[model samples]
Target: MSGNTGYAEIATFFRRQIADGTLAPGDSMPTQKQVRQQFGASITTVNRAFQMLKAEGLTAARVGQGTTVAERPRVAATATARLRRISRTGRAYGPKERSVDHQARLLSCADPDVAAELDIELHDEVLVRSRVYMKGNVRTIASFSFINPRGWAAVPESLSPEPLERFWQEDYKERTGRTTVKLPERRGARLAYPYELAMLKVDAPPNAAVPVLVLLNTWHDEDGPLEHWQDVFAPGLWDSDEE
Candidate 1:
């Protein structure tokens, strides 16, 4: 076979097997060499077929484990659940209040996009707080929050060491007599960056082609934008707009 014919044939063979239960989830796939020999196909054809399987989330290849039928992808909690929990407990996720593990830092707002989002001049200093919600040792969701110092000058010089989402909410209400009414969000997906990969502490799926969910959210009140932040959810680790 030539052109895409060989690729399609090889991919269809595996797809059929998976559907027929011949290749069960968590089962190891034949090695590339074995596939090549069995299909009398080129290495390129075999690789293409494997790529298709991975893109379809039907298989995965690990560094030392070779290719295997992928296990069922984990489903994460909905954003509504997280928000309701935060509203009640002042933390993103944890059995106890104020237990979400997180970090915070002050950084110069150098990125033009961030500056634009915060309506601040380039190079202005902003406080960036990052929260990582975990189910035990397994990380569930990661959030980065950016606050414009000028708009929130009333914030105390020293912020509490705990996760700041609840604190911020309270402070904003106290100062402005307004609650955050809208969280306009944009959602997309892209391959994790180096820093994101390190922070999430997970290897990219199969061929480094699986993209994680990126959610950009801007909090607004009657006045204007209050805060702009981004949340990066690990693959299969979050669902939003759940009905």
Candidate 2:
């Protein structure tokens, strides 16, 4: 087979083995040299096959550990699922949201994209609250709440540690004595950036072609935008109602 076809065939061979349970999670894959010799393929071909598997979240390579089968991919809870759950429970999705176990950090907003989203100036301070939703051991969703420093300071004492969504809503009411009328959300897919990959603990290499779902939300009233939110999810973690 041609070099290109060899790489694809190599990836397919391993993918089928993984699907059939022949190559269980944590099972070590053959070394690149071994694979190249076994298939009579070039080193480039074997590396390409490994890259493909890594992008699919099926395998990982680490220093001193070699490449091994990854844990089964977990499906993330969609926004629709969370909303339905909230409708039934009359609360946030579950204890995770209500608890203080998630990660939150305050940082300077150096990224122009985030500054524009929050209607703030570059280098301004922002409060970023993050939570990773896991299905068993596999991380499914990584959520971030970006708040303008001014708005965060104005939040009431009672709602100091509340969810970002709740904080925004309450802050708006406290300031204007009126409720927010609109929360617009936009969703799209993009390759995981380095910071996101590290945050999510994804096993893919930098600039890998794995697709991550990006959900952007902005809370607004007659005055203007209240806060901006960005949620990143592993592929298949979130399914939109429209899709």
In model 1, the runs with Cα more than 4 Å from the true position are 1-73, 78-80, 88-101, 204-210, 240-243
- What tens-digit string does per-residue lDDT give for candidate 2 at 24-62? 678899899888877888888889999998997778887
62-111, model 1: which lDDT tens digit per residue?
88889988753343334454565455444454231122556767789888
Against the reference, the lDDT scores of all candidates come to 0.66, 0.67
For each candidate, how many residue pairs have backbone atoms clashing (under 3 Å)?
0, 1
Among all candidates shown, the one with the greatest TM-score: 1
Off by over 4 Å in 2: 1-74, 78-88, 94-101, 156-168, 171-176, 236-243
TM-score of each: 0.57, 0.56
